[model samples]
Target: MKEDINNDRILLERLKNGDISCFEILYSKYSGKLYNYVLNISKGDFYLAEEIVQNVFVRIWEIHRHIETEGSFGSFVYTVGKNMFLNVIKNRMQEYLYHDYIIEHASELDNTVEKEVEYKMLEEQINKLIEQLPPARRKVYILSRVKHLPNKEIAALLDISENTVESQLTKATRFMRENLSPYCEIIALGLFQFYVS
Candidate 1:
């Protein structure tokens, strides 16, 4: 363990100097443990776990310049990974609630033969919500969630840092949560129960 800690310090030093090979070494060493830690919290959502792990490494790389090591670097990485997983859970819950709101309202209108009309209205509302977002945030959200672009791709396309992409997505998701919460609580609860079961 002490040897691993010493190696991490050396790897962190190399990473701080913009050594991609060192970053790769660190990633190869830590990715599996971090993935398992994230997976447990995400309920085995591999994609989400992967995203969180990537973000944690990216953050470590970004902050390497100023990072003052007070303890084990591995512990630091784990702490960041855990927090990222929590954020993922929160974001997932919000998204699930929003999607559930659309489906539930659609189901209600289906029985009355106004399903098409109701679905269109819900779609319009969702679109409007997206439109109301700040331009950068909306773009990031659309590119990532709508167009299925990875964060790195979105960052490159937008000429922004990956952290910026993550930030924009986080903001967009929080905005959606605040807007959709009142209208979607029942749906959220039902979905949560279903998932728990």
Candidate 2:
């Protein structure tokens, strides 16, 4: 154990000195263990575990220079993973809360001609933006969001992995959010139903 810690310290030192190969070495040593650790913590969410593990390594690579070279790599990596898991929980909670809030407030925004027109315009703009996505991404977004297909269904229909379907949807949503900004929320709450229903 002592020798292993010593080796990790040396590897971290090399990482800090900009030896990129050390990052790969550390990843090889720790990634599987980290994946299983996060998977257990996430209650058997394989994709979420994989995402968290990948993010943990990306973060370590980003902050390698600032990391202390003489400490427990296991502890450092685990701490980062734990924080990310908490963040995911927090974000998911916020999403549910926001969705509930939107549903509750949806009626307040209903039956107003001006707002109706505005929402229609926003929906049109959103469709245009989606059309601008790359072909594969656009197809995935249309199938998942417009057609209201589940990721698994979209994957089967499109002959892609569920991960790829998820990736495309994420990118498409991000692009719309970036481009549409404040109106995207309104569309998410209002026009989403209008289009789907």
lDDT against the true structure, per candidate, is: 0.70, 0.76
lDDT of 2 by residue, 4-97 (tens): 4448888888898988877888998899999999999999999999999998898778667767755688877887787778768865876787
- RMSD to the true structure for each prediction, in A, is 9.0, 13.2
lDDT of 1 by residue, 52-147 (tens): 889888876765665544467778778778766765666678778867766877755345445445545555666788899888889998877665
Which pairs of residues collide in model 2? none
**Segments of candidate 1 deviating more than 4 angstroms:** 1-6, 100-197
Error of 2 at 17 (Å): 0.7
Best by TM-score: 2
